[model samples]
Target: MAKMPVYLTTPIYYVNDRPHIGHAYTSLATDVLARFKRLDGHEVFFLTGTDEHGQKVEKAAKDAGEDPQAFTDRVSQAFRELTATMGFSNDDFIRTTEPRHKAACVALWQALAGKGEIYLGDYEGWYAVRDEAFYGPDELTERDGVKYAPSGAPVEWVREPSYFFRLSKWLPELLRRYDLPEGHPDRIDIQPESRRNEVRAFIQQGLKDFAERPEKLDLSVSRTSFTWGVKVPGDEAHVMYVWLDALTNYITAAGYPDTAHPRWRFWPADVHFVGKDIVRFHTIYWPAFLMAAGLPVPRRVFAHGWWTNEGQKISKSLGNVIDPVALVEEFGLDPVRYFLLREVPFGNDGDFSRKALVHRLNGELADALGNLANRTLSLIQRNCEGRLPAEAVRDASDAALFASLDTLLATVRNQLDQQQFHLALESVFASVRDANGYITQQAPWALKKTDLVRMAAVLRHLHTALRAYATVLQPFMPATMAALLDQLGVPADARDFGALATPLPEGTPLPPPAPLFRKLDLPA
Candidate 1:
C-alpha cells in the first residue's frame, strides 16, 4: 500500500523573542514526527518559521533603532538558524514578511471579504501585545491595580478600527467535525483528548449566546494601529492583525491563492503542533478563518505544555530561560534531544535542570545504550576477529539476549503513531538495559575462553540487536545513531526500518568502536 503524505508544522514563533527552550521543544517534537514519517516511507513536508509582524515587532524595531524589515530579517534568521543549530530537518522556514506570505495573506483577506464574512468595526478590549491576542475582561487577572494576561503579560485597553471576521458563524461546523466515526478516513484528529474537550466547552458556552441567535463576534482580523504587518487588502491605512497574518503562514506554505501550485498538494495540514497557551488560536480561530476562506481546515491541532526551570516559570525576568543552543554546545545535540523527550511525557510540562540532564546523559544514553554498543563492538573485535562472526545456535543463553530486539520495531512504530515519544524511547532503552544485563550473564569474553562457537553466536546476536537499536533510534538521536550505525558497517541507504527486520550479514567488517556518549564531568 502507498503511504499517505504526512504534513506537519510548528507554530511560526514570534520574532520579538529570541529562540529559547519553548521554541526548541516545539520544533524538536515536530522534527521527530517528520523524521519518523520519512522512515515510514511517507512524503513529508515540515514547516517552521518566524511570526515577524505585529505591534511588538514594530516596537522592537524602534527599540533597536533599525528598520522594521532589517529587524525582522535579523531575528527571523535567528529562528531559521535554529533548525541547523538544533539539527532539525525542517523542509521550509517561512516568514510572514515574505512576499509569498504577503500575497497569500492578501488572497485570504479577499476570500473572506468576498464571502461577506469580514466587516469594518471598532475593537474595544484589552489586548496582550506579547501574545498578539485580544482578551476579554474576565480573562485578565487584577493585581496591584494592573491587569495582566493569563501568560502574565501586561494588557492594555486598545480601541481601534479593525476588520472583523464572523468567527462564531462556523462554530457549529467545527463542533460537527470534532466527533466523526472512529478511524474514518476524513475525520479530523485532535490529540491529547484533554485539549479538544477544553475547546469544546468554551465554544459550547459561547453557543448559548447563539441559542438566541446565530453567534457572530466580529473577530478583529486587521488593525490600523500597527504598521509592521501585511497591509489590509485595499485598506492601506490598516495592517493585517498579526494573528490572521501569522495563521495564514500555513496556507502560504501550501501555495494558497495559487491553488494550482504543486506545493498546494500538501494542503489541510495533517497536524499543527502548537503550545497549549495558543490552542484557541490554532484550533478555534485558525479553522474559522480557513472555513471563511472556503478552504479545508487542518486535520489536527496538538497542543503541548510548557517547560519550567527548577519549579519556577521560565521567564526572561527571572533569567531562567533555557537556551537550546547552549544545551547543544555543552552537551552533544543528540543527547540533549534525547533527554528532553525522554525525560518528560510529550503532552506534559517539563522541568529543565542541569542535574537531571546530566543524569540522563550518564545513565540512559551513556550507560545503558552507549556502553552496550561499545562493549559489544569491543568484544567482537577482541574475541572473534575484527569482522562479524557467523553464529552457531549451540546454547540457549545465546538466543535469550537477542529476544529484546524481536518486537522493538512494531512497539516503537505504534508509540510514535500515538505521539508517545518518551514511551517509545523508554522502550528502546529498556531493551538496552536488558541487553546490558544479558551480556553480563552470558559473559561473551568468558565464552571465548571455553566455547568459541557460543561466543560467536552471542557476538552475532549482540550485533543484530545493536543494528535494530540504531535503526529505531535515528529519529531521536540522529547524529549519534548515524555514527553508531556507521561503526556497525551498515550501508547508508540500508539504514532504515526495513533493515531492522533483516539480520546483519555475518562477516561484515566493522570499524573500531568508540564511546558513543561521553560522561559529563561537571565541576563542583
Candidate 2:
C-alpha cells in the first residue's frame, strides 16, 4: 500500500537556555503526532533542533570569552538531548551552524536575488536583538521609561548598511495568497483579520521599504562585522540577517536547496508549530521569503498561546520560570505530559500551577484510569486463573463500551488532525470513564462465583476494552501503555489500533502487574 507522506516540525529552540515546560509541551505534541502517523503507516519525517546563530548567542559567547561556534555547540547539545529524555523519535536535528545549513541559507539568498527580490540598502530603524526583529516606530511602546517591542523585548535604534528584500512589494501578493483556503501551498499563515487590517492601514499610510535612506542607500553583499553566521554568497564582508538565516533552518533540516538529497521529501512542511509571540515573523516574513525564493510555503502555521506561572508570565529574571525536567522527575513523565495537554486548550493562553498538577494526577490518572486498570486486571487474576479467557458473546454493557470506543477513536483522529491535542485527550478520558462505569454495572467479580460462563464473557470484554484503551493511548503515554500491554503479555509494537480485537489466546499467562500511576502528594 502506498502511504501518505507526513512531515512535522517544532520551532527549533533558541539555545539561550535549557528546555522548559513550553519547549517540552511543543516537542511532546509533535512527538505524539509523529508516532500516531507512523503507526498509521505514513512515510513520516519529523525534524527538530536548536536555532544556534543569533545576536543573543553572540553576546552570551562574548561574555563567556568563547567563540560563538563553541558556545553554541554546548548549548545545542543540551537541546538535542531533550528528544531522548522525553522519548521523541525525531529523524533529523539540524543546527543553523552546520555547513549544509549555511549552504542552504546562501542558496536561498541567491535564489531571492536572482528573482530581483533583494537589493542593497542602508537601514536605520529600531532593532530588537532580543526578539531578532526590526520594529517600525508604530509598533513600539514606552514602558517604565524604556522602549519595548510588543512582546516586551527591549529595542535599540541602529543604522547599518544592509541588503533588503522588497517586502513592501509582496504585500498585495501576500494578502491575495492569504485569502486562499486553509491548505493551499501558496497560503502561509498570514496576518489575522485584525493584524491584516493593521498592516493594510500601515500600507495605506504609505509604505516605505527603507526606513531611513532610499536614494543614497549603500547596500552591499558583505560586511566585515561578524564571523558567526553564513557569509553573503559573493561578498564575505556581510553575513545573512539572523531572521533570514534562522527561517531557512526549516528547510535546511529537510535538505533544502538540494533536490537530490535523500530527506528532500519532507519539504513543504505539513505544519510549523510556533508560539504566539513570534506569530508575525512566522506568518508574514517567512512566507514572503519562501515566495521570493520560488519555494512552496508551508501548509500551516499554528500559533499557540503562552504559559504563565501562578497567573504571571514566567521569567527567569523574576525567578518564576517553571523547570519542566524537575516537574517530570517529581511527578513522572506521563503525568506532566497529560496535565499540560489536557489543562490548556490549544491556541489559548494558560497558567501553570503545582496545585493543578496534583489535582489532575490524583483526580484523573490515579483515581480514574489507574483504578480502571487495577480493577479489571485484579478480577482477571482471581477468576480467570491469571490468564485471558475467551469471550463467546458480549452482553448489553459490553455493547455500550464498543459503541463508545467507536466514537472515541473517531473523535481522537479528528481532534489531532485539527491540532486540537487537548480535545483528543479528553476523548480518551471519556472512554476511560465510560469503561469504568460499564465494569461497575457488569459486576464481573460477582458473576464469577455463580456463573463461570458469564464471568468468562465479562473478563473477555474487559480484556478487549483495556487492550483497545492501551492502543489508543500508545502515542500519548507510551511508557504506561507499554507496561499495560506487558501485563497482558502483548508485545509493544503489536498493539496498533486495528489489532485491538486480535485477542490473546484462551489461556495466555500474564506478566506481573504494576501500578500504572502513583498519586501526587499534595502539600499542606
- What is the lDDT, from 0 to 100, of the residue 418 in candidate 2? 78
Which candidate number would show the highest TM-score if scored against the true structure? 1
User: lDDT value for candidate 2?
Assistant: 0.78
Task: Compose the digit string of candidate 2's lDDT tens values, residues 334-388.
Answer: 8887788889988778999889989998988888888888888888788777888
Model 2 steric clash pairs: 121-219, 222-237, 222-238, 223-237, 223-238
- TM-scores, in order shown? 0.96, 0.92
Each candidate: what lDDT? 0.86, 0.78
Top candidate (lDDT): 1
Superposed model 2: Cα runs more than 4 Å off: 183-185, 189-227
lDDT of 1 by residue, 1-524 (tens): 87888889999999886899999999999999899889878899999999989899899999999999999899888888889988899999898888999999899989999999998878888998888888767678988998999888899999888878898788877787778765664455677799889888878877875577653455788888867889987889999888899999999998888889887888889889999998988888888898878898888888888999978998888998888998899998998899889889988888888888889999888888889999999998887678998845546765555566788888888898788899999889888887888889989899888988878888787888888889888989999999999999899988878666666677889989999999997435
